[model samples]
Structures are given as structure tokens and as C-alpha cells.
Target: MTRRLVATGLVVGLLIVLLIRTGIEQANLNRFDRDMGVILTAMKDEIIRAEGGGVALDSFVTQLPGWQQQLETIPPPTNSGYRANLLQSVLQFTVEYGKMADTQPDQARTAEMVENLTQAIAGWDEQLRNGPGEAGHSH
Candidate 1:
């Protein structure tokens, strides 16, 4: 029964392809997670250091565009809305921080900006730990 053998071969081939695709997707997801963690943490730390007068905002401002580009370039895992949302939040953070640096906001406003950025970072971290639509996730 050559027909039967060919049918079985086709199924096996398709299963192999599926497995390879799944593995590739998993790898991509892992890379995205690792890279985003570092990027986001660095951003939060830089802002906190600047707010506390531990470091100048000049360096952080200089690095914002690169961070933004990296965020935009990293491809999220398939069907992962949380990862997509997290990237957007981080990108927005960079934009807001850049604007603040340009305008030299008042001390009170700086505090407010830091608070908002902290909350956003915390929320994204929680989502990354928990899943896309978890209780603590706002977006």
C-alpha cells in the first residue's frame, strides 16, 4: 500500500515541522524575556539615580534613543499580548523621560514623573512574572 505509506510520511513530516516551529518560537520568547528584563531594569535604575542626584541625566538622555529603538526592534513571542504591551510601556517611558530632561521640569514634577515611571516598571515586571491578563496588570 504505497498510498498508505505516503500518507503516513506526510503526517510525520508535518509533525516534525510543527516541532521545529515550536522550538524556534520558544527560543525567541526566551531571548525577548532576557533582553527586555535588562533593558527595562536599566531604564528604571537610570531614572532613579538621576532623580536622587546620584548621576547626571545627560547620559541617560543620550541612551534613550537607543533603548527606544531596541524596544521597537525586539520581536515578541507569538501571540503574546503582554510582551507587546510591556514594550510599548517602556517605549513610552523613554519618550516621557526624554521630554522631561529637555524641559528641565520642576522638582515636584520630577518626583511625579519618577513615581509614574516606577509604577509602570513595576506593573510590567509583575505581568512578565504572572501572565498577560493577570490581576495586577493594568494594560
Candidate 2:
């Protein structure tokens, strides 16, 4: 009887620990989703507004550093595939942006930036399709 009681207590304790761990993970995922949403929305808005104007493009370029800083704050993914995809998207966009900056300065640069932005957005869409959970944790 004593052995059975001890076994039951051990099982109950492990169950409680599992439940607590799951809850904490869920909370972290929620926070990650919120942060990613905020950053992505801001980036989309800026890109849309910068589609034509030189001033807008300049402003958008100026904002890139801040966006990068925010992105860096995102926690490492629990899943390797998701993390790799996210990193790939970020790197591809950065390279495309650099290409735009190196090209001749004009509305042409703005157009290139817009095109690269579109590609980057598509990369993000692909990431969403390949993301880990039903809840779509972004960070």
C-alpha cells in the first residue's frame, strides 16, 4: 500500500511539472507572436508607403536598422527548421537591400527596394506555411 501511494505521488508530481512547463511554453509563444506581428506590420506599412517616393525610400532605409534591432531581440526558436527559415528570410532581405543601395540613386533604387521587399514578403509567407505550430509562433 505504501509503495502504491509513493508511486501515485511521483506520477502526480511529474504530471504537474509537465502541465506547468506546457503553460510557460504557451505563454512565451504568445509573446513571440505578438512581437513579430508588431514588427512585421510596421515593416509592411513602411514598405508600402515607400513604394514610389525617394523621401519615403530614404526613410525606410533609415528605419531598417531599428527593425533589425527589434528582430535580433526575438528569442531563438525551439524548432530548428523554423529558426533556419527565419534566418534565411532575414539574410536574403538584407542582401537584396544592399543591392538596392549599391545601385544608382534614383526612383530606380526605390523600385528595386520595392521589388526586394516583395520578395522578402514572399519569403515570410513561405515561412508561415512551414511554421511549427497551429498557433503560428513567429519568434
Return the TM-score for each candidate structure: 0.76, 0.73
Residue-wise C-alpha lDDT for candidate 2, range 69-94, written one tens digit per residue: 77777784474446545655674565
RMSD of 1: 3.3
Relative to the true structure, how large is the alpha-carbon lDDT of every model?
0.72, 0.66
TM match of model 1 to true structure: 0.76
Cα lDDT of model 1 by residue, 1-139, tens digit: 9999999999999999999988887788789888888887787787677666424445567788898888888875555666777777778877877787667745414556667666877777767656676454342
Residue 37 lDDT, candidate 1, scale 0-100: 82
Worst lDDT 10-window in candidate 1: 105-114
In candidate 1, residue 128 scores what lDDT?
Answer: 68
Judge candidate 1 against the unseen true structure and give its global Cα lDDT, from 0 to 1.
Answer: 0.72
lDDT of 2 at 59: 73
